[model samples]
Target: MKIAKLSLLFLFLGSFLFAQNQKFTIAEAVNGLRSNLAVKNISQFSWADDGKSYYQSAKNAYMVTDLASHKGDTLVSLYQLNKNLDLDKKLKTFPRITFITKDKGYFTQDSNYFWVERSGKDWKVRDWINIDKEAENIEMLSDNEGFVYTVKNNLYLNRNGKIVAITDDSEENIVNGQAVHQREFGIEKGIFISPDNSKIAFYRMDQTMVGDYPIIDWSVVPAVNKNIKYPMAGTPSHHVTLGVYDIKSNTKRFLNIEGDPEQYLTAITWSPDSKSIFVGVLNRDQNDMKMNQYNALSGNFIKKLFEEQSDKYVEPQHPLLFFPNSNTDFIWQSQRTGYNHLFHYNVDKGLVAQLTKGDWVVTEVLGFNEKKKEIYYVSTQVSPLERHLYKVDWTNFKTQRLAQGVGMHTGILSKDGSQLYDFYSNATTPRVVNVINTNTLKTRNILSAENPLKNYDRPEIKNVTLKADDGTPLYGKIILPTDFDANKKYPVIVYLYNGPHAQLVTDSFPASGNLWYEFMAQKGYIVFTMDGRGSSNRGLKFEQAIFRHAGETEMKDQLQGVAYLKSLPYVDADRLGIHGWSYGGFMTTSFMLKHPDVFKVAVAGGPVIDWNMYEIMYTERYMDSPQNNPEGYKQANLLDKVQNLKGHLLMIHGAQDNVVVWQHSMNFLKAAVDHGVQMDYFVYPGHEHNVLGKDRVHLMQKVTDYFDEYLKK
Candidate 1:
């Protein structure tokens, strides 16, 4: 009778727990997030030269809104523009506007080859002559009479009554046009148009040497494999070469930079005079990098302005800024000082001057205002946990905070660098976007002020710094339950993603947390994440300390975090579990496999089982080639350490992950199976690296059930 009463009591609690865990629907959560989604997610907003009006994309058309009057008018339909100058005149009736110009008013068009110019609300068709050619990439360059367009990857000049091909290289491998994925994902456009349409520097990605990885498409009648040139880790990546085309002479010449064929030519930009083009070349190991300059027309190597070397790795993400009204100068961001700092180099003398120096790292280089001799950028200087906008004098390095907020803030300065549009947010405060004056640091107008998660109850998130085994400072965060109790002992879940280019502990409210952490906390689980060594926002040395041993150093920091959590009187060490996705997933599984006694449960999602399975660009920089560093590769492979697995491990992966690939999870699954290790597994069919939409709900529910079953009750 006593056992039956206890069983009834347990049954009631289980029912209540299940009900509580399944309160919100995925659609409801998505809807709520979407409704309160950051309003300042403006992709590309252009202001008029006078700064009186700005053009923004809304719905299907580009709308020009007057900042002074708050009045907006439809400029063009972005979907209606074509390259062959074949635009349907019918699109004009639909308020079609692709892009607008300040001096030329508005540019409107439809998919066919019809472009119209609007002056004072009056529209006039500028180009209506339909030739027997199919238009593809139509672009309006400057306020000049001639417009630049491309047909079948061949650039052309369309003006008055003549259409001339500036680039005749229409071969399959020698593409002279712009590519979407190359531009969007790689954040670089294949085409570079000169300011005055005198020359064009375009990217030519020769994939003829690349081996194609087959992608299976099961949606067809007979599932067929599609060939894609996916350069895996340690493999020969696609060769990218820059080609400069002269519009007047219709001549094309490739820049002759001194480097190996496999070396990466990144951050290609034209000097102020446009006579020379600058290129940063990085070797495969990514340890050595050089900034080379070459004549745009003659293709002659001009000068090697700046060079950087690191014991582990070096990255060339910052663009070389050419100061106006000066002959010998360019700005570069480097981690040579142990932290990412700005440096000015003279082209004539090849002398480098450190512009900004500190322990804080510059997150981004917004731009250099030559007139004021000031450099504006975003950095984590205020506090490593939060990012803020800052302006510094290029000469004296006098720093000033543009947006004085105790949160993650980002801003976009006007074209003239007089005004800035700022967005600020934190874990508790929703994002707010406002226009501010750069000189006075005063806000002009608030574009948006809405709380994304105002309705939902938010957890109390706090930052905590812990010491690693070597006594190095490690930053971490803990998200407490809505109704947190310090007296009760709770199971702890350590969220991790301690990769070189990642930082989990931040002031910004984590979008992935949702009710999941809250649900866990409600079930008496302590959730925490630590930005271990090799994580981003830290100095180059701090980040590269784990080179060749990605998990070794990170695992130490994480274990330190675990020890810190264990020190908390309310933390149940026996019920400790670790969870991570991608790189974090690798670390989690590696931790559990390496130290199984420390963790009771672990979940590694879409993890890279071996470093050999990752992408060449990122993987080679840290772990080198698998052939060269066999021991390092062996150490990175969690499969090799699977024998130490004693925890209840749950492995999850998307069936069609092209990034980490499903093969990684499959290999681990096979290894665990062969080793007679009991493990739980799940796969989201037709999902890629990240599982979203309706399927994500099921995934979260599964994760919740897994953690609740093992770590909670």
Candidate 2:
């Protein structure tokens, strides 16, 4: 009787454990991210501030190793961190720790700041009130020095326990310490600190001049009008100015840049001495840009280094990269020769030499090694589909490959650039992180992530290469449905975003780069995505092939993909669907109008129906101005071609989309009504550009259902 009771108790424990572990669902996968379903990964692997030691992190623990000795020890214990802190909530894992000095480290638990100091056999923690609770984009200089943050729409500097307001503007339209120019020219942040961190420079965008676009809130008792600052094309744009703040004086001064107020202020950079600041000031027309520098203290214009002008437009995405320990020479990224390459420039000597040149483009510059006079970067030197890390020696300008195997490899270099923590992922490999000693070229494997969705009904994703109309090589990825059979035919779903600066067909894991594609594959749809002409990472010839004709070449190239899809024995040509977002949305509509009989169904999200309605920077770069290229605008406009759309097309928007604007879709609906074209429409309330978060599952479900109802015959 005693043994039977013990067995019953064990069975009860097993049932309780089983109840706690729930099976993953579609909603759980989309919303919760099924955090428990994520692949076990190396949490935070970084070279310590000392440069001689590095740390590899886990959930609750971290291991630090000395490079010279290859000896490692537990650096921080989350258990100890929790014990030292007093809080209402108990922490589960280690915080985001950043080592400032040899002994001091700072971390954050949500928004609360914690500074931990190392003692002999114990760790001491303290709660500091130097940081603002409402601060955003906090860039700290040191442990106790100060930090720069933005609250609401203004800039603030919290220094040595006192918070100083930089911009006291009460208007939300006057945005400070944020990226401007609709996020073009690679302006992601408004804050740029000096090397010494004594002064801070930030962008001040005054969008009060722009028009207000109102959006309604249907979810509320009474729909309210929420107006957004939208600077449309061929209209009055926002004026931007660069301001510098001195910590000692707590004063602000704007740079004396000579240009129209509505012109673009991009590629913000600081001198090594912090005495000067540089900016790429483009004109209102955006066809020309003057790379100029100014005095940081006096706020006076220094000199114009160089100028770039194009009949179409000149876009400056990268900033000035100064040489290590030297301020005289710097590297600049330009696409003057129809290809983006690196150019070495001397402030006094003018253009010294072009460091890198070829048909390929240098995607990103990692860092520079001062001792060895080498700079590391990732480029499309091998192939446009793959990105590999390479080191270019400054002496001879010879390049050496650093990354092993294929796919996109990105790395974080040490302060001295002698060591690197490399991270990579590909279609086959889930993830692989490594530590490399640059001097000896010796590398050690740190962590390799396993396939997280191994238990799911994954599809067979493979890379497909097809030729464009002009015989140019186009790369694409196709997902065969789970339990795919050769005898039975399957419907095709052409998923694409065949626009500039986006290459969907990459050697990335989950092979399609989106889990939604696999989810649709589980529903038995053969998904396809290709990077046609005018897509990024390829040479300028390929990307600019659609110049003056945005949707023409991309559509024709996609037709080549369709021709290849029809050639496949398992593909059903009668039931075909197409899906694209933004530029892809533009292409999807264009294909339906151009082909007519090819696609049976299509779904477009936030697509640009007319180039004139798009932003100035991006639209003008390819199609020039609406005033100049009226024919290109007329040809690409889907508004007039609504009569040609034979497929069942569905256009979805964020309702308040500021990028493409809702007017693009609203205008299309007006034309559709005039032409009496039947179509489907949906909108996600309070969404902009794209419908994200948990609601995105609903968006995809709506899209899947549209194709299922029409094409899944």
Candidate 3:
């Protein structure tokens, strides 16, 4: 009897102590992940050229550690870098460094590029170059010979110390050396340097035919109008062409790509010998693609390597990766098998072999091992929610998993593909960085990040899985209120972004998914999130289910989540709330107006009210065109459904948003007024798309206040 009494007393004391722990403030919940509550990590972690050592930035210094001995030494300090550069005011931190060799690296400070070399027990700045302060989209040559940059609407090459004008187009409408196609089709940069460093290929876009749109800056005395070229769906788009500039001859020529001017040119690649270029030419309808090879010097079409066609759409996002030492064969990433897989193609023969095949997709290709004929890549073969590292033999198609973690794993391979630097995180693990020997599968943990929220009164998070109407397994997370009581009912908030190219339910740190969700849970609200069918990383079939009709299938999956939530005895079904941003914002608005009796409150930011007003690249790829699918657009458009809204809806938008545009919300307001419907609206002046930085705390606070006012009441 005495021992049992003592046990009860100790248990009471432990519960009291746990309840006294910290709780996240609105500001902390909004920005703590990047600041006070940030997980400790090895900053700028990279592998050495030899794969025997690795480098990282720490304590304002760059350090390298040997993998065999696990011994570390400081390579360069901020003091040495500042002293070598002769800066008037010392730099506060070490600049980001990229290693070209074991002893040579380069870093940029301000507009100056500094190349450094390892000296005797120290480092010294060997060479440097200064470009214009206004230069954008800078691409440096691999050999450190020169760089290409764009100023305003032209391209310039800085070779050694000489600056040459590569393009001198006068019209701003005809932009040179910049990303085109609204930055779609996996095109991130405009410049591509050849292997031999003798030629440069860049994109030149002419947007004179595109419609001009104005973004107003109300901060000025009399609001200033900034004009931007915007191509709506089924409208004329910017014309893009590839241009090659020969460094030695100082002459430029356009590739002989015969197609519609507005057709997309993606998957740019250079032949190993630097004498040929390959491009994936996609038509404006985005249903057909052709891989064509062209002569580099003469700008002549060599041959059509291959052709891919799809009844829906053939979207090629990755460039063709050539073999290490051969130009006759290359690896192509395609969704031909309903999943993104690797296909080996030869220059003379059509298809050599399929390197990888499965229901899962290869997320990224790290590098190749020439001697062993192997390729390193990241894939979802283990599970759709987790990413793992694997290496495959290109010759025989035998694959082996390298990392032993059940989470999202990303890696950097060494020069010979013998070592892999694996970095990953899971629900319980904040972060872990490991160095693994590919041959032996021996692992060494270099970093194990401590949980940043250990002291906080965190809510109990659980993984929830439900089957869709078509019996597809859908993953979700539910964060119960702090010090949960199963007997008492709780209000629920479903935070979701059920759109393309995004997956919310991942095996990442903080099982609550987002910090803001955890914050709301502490305030006695249950937070839930799920990845619907339209989300990415599944396969072509799962994603294409929402084709032509954007919100129908996704809504079916979300309703399954709703059914699961309502089935729980502790859920207060009448007080449910919803929130999302961008594509998520569209989802939130769609749910509120379509299912008026389900949710009681919603906060949507930067919602796409109409698909016809969106940009051409993304809009047409999924919904075709307004003229092509009028009924689909009419059904998805929120303007006609304004009268059906019965919830406490708060719509937010960035006044100068260029991505979704401010008109999406403004037009919705006009329609609501015309239809005699009432809703709350807010605007963040001088902000774009999403409200970020310190002001984000205010935005989240407003959202939290709305939930507290309506749902809690």
Candidate 4:
């Protein structure tokens, strides 16, 4: 149970440096220096409208490829693209280009927009649009004539040559064209444009009644207090309403959605004709949901098409997907049968048929074919630990697996559903890219990447399967220390994020799936990771098992990992340590304090001390309000168990973190002080939520130092 590869370190200075330069050190891995060692990918690839050709930015130029010949040519030279936009051609880098049709493509150089056309065989370029100023969320209309964007927190519509202000409110509480509900329920942008580009729909949120949490900017001489509108659980949340604007008449009307304004309006969708809009309305309690229809032109409430209810919560993350040719028929995803599956529905007949019924989850729905008879998706049907691409027929629910691989896979289909670009990766493989003919299923390897870490002294990684206390199977991975000795004992570190929408252990890349894990093993420590209940990609029961309980059930499942670790003969039980961020941070802190004697040291970053202090949308959906489920809230609250802490614990947070908030760990420190307990604490100045980019190297170094001091020594 050791690293199978030979060490490349030289004989004299053998401890740190490798001979030729293949040392998997922390500085290179965390400072983003090792990114060049990763498998090269054909970035920004786009399928053409013809379904037999594609455009890709590869080898420093945009290349067009024909499927039959398996050959490519330069679509636009970097020099030509830069010269056409009247820019300096200093660095030959390809711009972000997207295909509009078989022969037409659009790209941006600075604020200037350019359109390149495949005139016969040579590319003809012309200036398209000049963005006069900086804007956010710049989304072009379908006709490519105009776009909707945000400037200074207000919505604006630019059609032809005229720029019109869609909203004029100046208050911070009245924000427009930004994500609402704290980015929950899959609401990314607030603006929506109609099919004909004559009307626009946007969200108007009034956070005037919500509380403003103070966030200090420590970079200033005297830290300034910046208040952000944060609605905690059982608190007064913000109210949101949708408004439609008519560009020709310069008129606006609000949709008459009948509900409490604090309730959630999620998964917004428009009909193909743009005459009607569909919205999923969930109450503040999050137990009941109704798919309601509204008239787009008059901004009138139509009728409720269907409803879904659960004792815990019903989350809607996807919009109604209409067929390519039919305006009335659409597909909807639901977990009403204890599993997430797709169902075909008609506007008039309600449920047409259950299209996809399985014990697995459909992770994503790519799109439908041109004929509206088949759909492409990524699902967990092959295995819970692996994702595979598939196409399911709408008529009979016949499924065909695409992009042959044993691990995670994703693919993009052509507009006519003739060509598919399959990109996949697995445990032993670094990366694999393939092109498959959709009709014949004939495949060709475009790029079979070699293992980049082949020369490094890598640790052996093995996936382990165990069972929970409830007889449910659990998936995990164990990484043995590099240059391990069977006769000697080693301290183990359990890294996890066992929460909803978070799955730590997967069947992708090097088995361990994280460089930090391998680095820890190289430092003479075993690393373990597992996805307990309440994690994602399993069926509904696995994901919802921890509802209203939060950390309770996950702890039960994670303890199973601890039991397995303890049973190992070479594992040092007295020196077990744990580390995690966000929810995993919550788990790390909870495991140390709640169990007291199970682990020796723990490092938690941006953890949840009390569930009541969390946001309204995410917290209430899982744990319910403190008023509704007081016992569950009290059980999961870490502040209650601070007196039981018996290990070397370290807590870290960003000074300006607003997601989990700085107050969470700060309050935990206060609780420890009041209970006459001592724990280590650190803060990153001017950082929010997680320390990212180059600063993350510092964060990981601190984490590694704590484990070394408490466990290794």
* Candidate topping TM-score: 3
Per-candidate TM equals 0.84, 0.91, 0.96, 0.95
Model 2: lDDT of residue 210: 86
Lowest summed-lDDT stretch of 10 residues in model 1?
179-188
- List per-prediction Cα lDDT, in the order shown: 0.73, 0.84, 0.91, 0.85
Poorest stretch of ten by lDDT in candidate 2: 20-29
Superposed Cα deviation of residue 705, candidate 2 (Å): 2.1
Model 2's alpha-carbon lDDT is 0.84
Report the C-alpha lDDT of model 2 over 1-713, residue by residue, as the tens digit.
99999999999997776654334355544543336555556767677765798877765767788877888888878777777667864567667777765467887765667778788767777765545677887877643577788998999887767778989999899999988888898888899989878789999999998888876676688777788776655668889999999887878899998768988998899999889999999987777999998999989998999999976667788999998999889999998987888898988778988888788899999898998999988888888877888889887999898869788888889888888888888887888988888888899887798877655667888889998777888898889988699888999999989898888887766577777787778788899988999998887788878877899888889889999999999999998999999999999888888788999999999999988888777887788777877898899988888999888999999976878888899999999999988899988878989888778879888998898899998
Better by TM-score, candidate 4 or 3:
3
Candidate 4, 1-713: lDDT as tens digits: 13323333243356445643355778655643247566667788888787778888866577888887878888777665555444543335666778787567788777777787776645667877766576888889898987888886788887775788989998977988778999999889898888778788888899999998999998988879999999999899999998888888999888889979899989888888888889899999999999999998887888889999998889888889998877899999888887778889998889999887788888888787766478888898988888898888999889998777788888888877777788888899878999887667889998888877776768888888989888999999999998789888999999989988888777787677788888889899999999999998887789888888888889999999999999999899998999989999999999988898999999999998899999999999998898989999999999979999999999999999999999999999999999999999999998999898778889999999999999997
lDDT of 1 by residue, 1-713 (tens): 99999999999998776654443343444333554343345545666655667776677566777766678886655343222234553343344344446424334333324455654544454554343256555565564455566666566667654777767764554455555223311335566676566787876666667666666666677887766556777777767778888877878888887667777777777776768888878887778888888998899998787788887777777667766666568777778888988888888887567887899998887765556888889998888888988888877878898876677888776666776677777776556676666776667554555654444545677678998777879988787765678887878888889986677767765433344665566555678988888898888767887888778998888888888888988788899988989998898899888888999988889998988877787788788888778888888888777778888889999876788878888888888889988899998877888888777778877887788889886
Where model 3 places Cα greater than 4 Å from the true spot, the runs are: 1-20, 82-92
Query: In the order shown, what is each candidate's alpha-carbon RMSD?
Result: 7.2, 4.8, 2.8, 4.0
Backbone clash count, each prediction separately: 18, 0, 0, 0
Better candidate number, 2 or 3, judged by lDDT: 3
Q: Quick one: best lDDT, which candidate?
A: 3
